[model samples]
Each structure stands twice: as C-alpha cells, then as structure tokens.
Target: MAKLQLITPNVAYEQDYKAFYQDWQDSGRAIIPSVAKDLPADFAGYVQRLNDNAQGIGLEEGIVPNSTFWLVNEENNEVLGAVNIRHQLTPYLERVGGHIGFGLRPTARGKGYAKTMLALSLKEAKSLELEKVLITCDVDNVTSEKTILKNGGRRSTDEQTEEGIIVHRFWIDL
Candidate 1:
C-alpha cells in the first residue's frame, strides 16, 4: 500500500476515474455507490453530476445531501476506491443503506484497503457532527464485516430486506 488519501473526484483525475469505473463494471458487483447513479458517458457530465450531488442540486427523489470521496494512492495518484457519506439518514437508509457506503476496485480488494478506506470515511462522518455513524453490509460479506469491526463498529442487529437479503448493521461512536 502507498500513502493513501481521500479526495474529491475532479477533472484532473479523469483517467484514474475511468479506470476505477471500469474495474467496478468488470467486477460485476450488484450495488454501485450512490454518487455513481447518474454517471454520464462523458467526463464533463460525470464531473458535473458529482458536483451537483455534493451541493444537493438536482437530486432525485429520496436522495439526501451527501459527500463522495475517492481513495487515492498519493504516491502514484491512483484512484483505488470510493466512499459515500450521507449527511443524514432517511427511512430507507435507517433500515438498510446506513450512513456510509464504500467499495474498492476489484484489483484493490484483499489488500486491507477496505479497512483503511472505511476508517477514513468514519473520520469524514464524524466531521459532519454525527455522534455515531451507521454502517451496513450484506451478511455474507465477510470482508466488509471484518472492516467494520476493525473500525470500532459494534454489531447492532440484522434485518432482511424486501428483496430477501439479510444485512448486518453496525455503529461506530465518534
């Protein structure tokens, strides 16, 4: 691992962003980050959408104000993963999504980056004045569970979604 830092995605990171996006697609992951919902084929539009979401502009229904950050290897400026922190929870989030959601490129997995990135996201959540942050992962996702635990997350409860998926929820006090 190189010196990693979370950064707001921008035009200067276009190539790195594309690589990350392609890796996500290649991984065949079912869930994408909230900030990736409106990604356009063009870099300019993608950048604009990221800015809009950050500012609470042109948000779709049921969306809350949030922040998105890309974890980058500062040594080589490689975009490795992304994390989204919701400013506040809605009914749906309270049940399922929680306050933070994160994913790493397939190539970046199993390198302990998830734990590192998650720990960083918790700091961002604390800065938002949240006394604690809620995080949830699918029950079958062992890596995620371990990451949450390493970040001081305590198992709160498990609930089944309408889609019949069991999710484990955890909370980390600030």
Candidate 2:
C-alpha cells in the first residue's frame, strides 16, 4: 500500500517493468489483459507498441485501440500492476474481454492495490469520454468480482466464452 500512480508504459520504467513481468511469469497465472503477455525482448519496442495501440496504430487483427497503464509505487518506484483500457469493444470483447482489464503483481496482491488501480483506470475511462464501461472477470475469480463491485460495477449477465469459461460481466457508469 504505497502511494500508487497509474502511468503510461515508458522506457523510463524498463527495469521495473522487467521485474514486474517476471513476477507475473513466476506466479504461473495467465497475464490479465493479454496485451501484457509474451513481452518482446526490446523494452523500448514494447513501450512503443503500447503507445501505438493507444493511437490505433499497427494493431493486430480484431484488436482495438487501447491504453495500457502501469500502477507504480511512487515512493519506491516499483511497478505494482497494469491495466488496459479499450477505447472501443469488439463483439468478442463485449462478451468476454470488457473495457478494462487489470492485474497486480503477486507480491502486490491483498494489499489493496487492485482497488486503487481500478479506481484510477475508471478515471481514465471517463477521460476517454465513455459514458460507461464494461468490466468482466472469471466467475470464479471472487477477488476480481469484489473489486469490480466495489468500483460501482453493476452485474449484467454471465457469458460463456467459446473456450467454455464462465465470465461475469459488469458495467460501471462513468
């Protein structure tokens, strides 16, 4: 529970980001916001990709423009977590991905960082002029469900992905 700030991905935080990435790798959980998965060796390139994604440049098929932010502990300069906010949703995203995807490092969990990180992401959503946002999580992921609920998310309906995963969808008014 350090002073947290959500920042756009940048080379200035390369080292911290590497460590954060490693932590997620070590946890053996699928990285939330698939954009954060399989990071390239070039940290600069990765940062640039995140920037490009925000600008709707060089996006892969079916991918929409999105903003990615790192939640950092300002006091210690540690990368605590990340959040990806999609500017618009595709059919698949509407059903499973939602507008916001976020996660904290294993070491940062259970310290109230997720809630704060999500609150900040909601602010970013509002800045994007979104009237509301869809946020989804695994139906079994109680922690995330709680976070979404605390953030004023209203339960919509559960969706089953093609992969057969049950996803809980919620909407928050901006």
Candidate 3:
C-alpha cells in the first residue's frame, strides 16, 4: 500500500513545491491554478499564494495545521498524488472548492491513489470535528467523481461557478 504524508510548508520543501508546480504545469494537466512561470520564481508571491489558499479555507488551526498531504510509494518515497484540507469552509468552498482539494499527479493518474488520498483526508477532517465535508470536482472529471463517490460522497448538485465552469459537489458525512 502507498503511504500518504501530510506536509506543512517549510524550507526543505521550498524547492519541491517549485518542482511540483513546474512538473504539473509542464505535464499539461489541469490541477493547480495556472501560475505565470515567473510567479513561481518570485518566492514571496509563491509563498503568499500557498498561505492564502490554505488560510482562505480555515485550514490553519485547530490541530489540523491547514496542510497538504502527499501520497507516496512508502518503499521509494515516490510522489503520486496530493490532497489539501482547509480548516474552514467558505461560501465558494461550499459550492465547489469543497473542504478538501486533491489531484493525482500525471505519473500516477489511476491506480486508486485519488480515492485513498481523499479517504485519508476525510479521516483527518473528522478528527478536527468536521461532521461532514464537501468535495467538488469538475463535471467532466469522471475519475475524480468516482473517487469521491467511492469514499461515501453523496451527490448534491452541479453548481456553475462565476467563471462558468460546472462543478459537481458532493457531501460526505463522517
């Protein structure tokens, strides 16, 4: 089984963050928000983005630490996928962003990593006293939809984002 590690932002991973952002962008996948190549190079902007994203959702406190989790092959420490849980939820989050955000890296697309990562995240969310959590994915992302449903996510409704993207929302009660 693959081991998943929840990581906090720190110096050791400063470069790893850059690399993951770069690799994901280069792989031509739609995961992290698109950043200008130069923005990642700008340390402050990069750090701020990361913090803002986590903080914006209240993932910064209550023993949760508002962090990101990396799914890895325990045997080799190979990074596969990641899921980030926010400490708090917002209106937008309720509609789409959800309480947890996850994605399978290009190299590990499939193999049930996404589902496992989310299941683990849900456990953590429950630990923080979250009775239920909302998770959303693009309507077209069948793989992610299935992963969520497999984790006991019940279908809610498709909401249209202000950006015009249709997002499928699911609610998972602990």
- Work out the TM-score per prediction: 0.92, 0.96, 0.74
List model 3 lDDT by residue over 25-96, tens digit each.
779766642222243456665555555655554433333335555555656555566667767776666667
Q: Model 2: clashing residue pairs?
A: none
> lDDT tens string, model 2, 117-168?
9999999999999999999988789999999999999999566564777888
Q: Per-residue lDDT of 47-146 in model 1, one digit per residue for the tens?
A: 7676677789988999998888999999888899888989899988998899999988889988999899998998888888989988988889898899
Rank candidates by TM-score, best first. Answer: 2, 1, 3
Clashes of each: 0, 0, 4
Whole-model lDDT, model 1 = 0.85
Each prediction's whole-model lDDT (CA)? 0.85, 0.91, 0.67
Better TM-score candidate (2, 3): 2
Q: Flag regions of model 2 displaced more than 4 Å.
A: none
Shift in Å, residue 16, candidate 2: 0.4
TM-score of 2: 0.96
